[model samples]
Target: MEIEYQYHFSLPRSVVWKYIKNERVLKNALPGCRSFSMVSNNIYKAEMDIHIGPIQDLFTLEIRLDEDQAPSLIELHIKGNGNMGQLNGQALLMLKENQGTTMLSCKANGQVTGALGLAGKRILDSSANKGLENFFQILEKEIKRRIYELKRRNR
Candidate 1:
């Protein structure tokens, strides 16, 4: 499966980059995430409870920051397993500043095997898109709130 997502933030790229690196913010942005913690430098563990159709399962995922260029780009590799199936994927994130806004984009490719994979491509794609939409919506709201708080404090 392939995943692509893009979001625009009114804040500067630097601010966006800083916020994204925060574990709390990332955890909140990921849909269905129950717990997120750092295991080591640039490596983290997360547990997510997801329900698709009538199936519900808790997945344990390990995420590694494979490559990064501060304030500009980051690459992540993730592996996850659950009673439903197994997932492995790599995602690349790019941040670009234009005027006062920051544009963030991601591209990911992965394989799903086992019960979840039986859902077929169309169903999986639709589910993935909905999940992405929900994730970004939460992220945007948090980013705006944090930016507002920072501005208020600096005043």
Candidate 2:
């Protein structure tokens, strides 16, 4: 399966980049995430409860930051398994700044096995798209909240 998404933030690319890699920000943004912890410098382990169509399961995922070009690009590799299925994927995220706004583009490709593989492409695609959208919305809010906290602290 493949997923692509684009989002615009009313903040500079540099500011977005500064907070994007924060563990707290990511943990708060990820939908249904129960636990998220770093396993190494660039690797993380996460447990999430995911629901797709009529199927729901708790997934254990290992995420690796494969490549990073600060304030511009990031590449990620992920693998996860649950009672429903297993998944493996790679994602490339690019950020472009225009004036004070930043545009984020994400492209991801993955394969699923077991029950999830039999769930059909349309269902999977819809669920993935919705999930990504929700994640980004929450992320933007979290970033803004953090920025507010920073300003308060500096005052």
Q: What number of clashing residue pairs does each candidate have, in the order they appear?
A: 0, 0
Candidate 2 structure quality by residue, lDDT tens digits, 22-91 = 7899999999999998989989999999898988999999999855677799999999999999999999
Backbone clashes in model 1, listed as residue pairs: none
The sequence of per-residue lDDT tens digits that candidate 1 reaches over residues 1-155 is 99898887777898887877678888988988999989999899999997666667899999998656887999999999999999899989899999999888989898988888887887777787788778877887888887788899999
Query: Lowest-lDDT window of 10 residues in candidate 2?
Result: 65-74
> Would you list the C-alpha lDDT of every candidate in the order shown?
0.86, 0.92
Could you give me the TM-score of model 1 versus the true structure?
0.90
How big is the positional error of residue 39 in model 2, measured in Å on the Cα after superposition?
1.1
The C-alpha RMSD in Å for every predicted model, in order, reads 1.7, 0.9
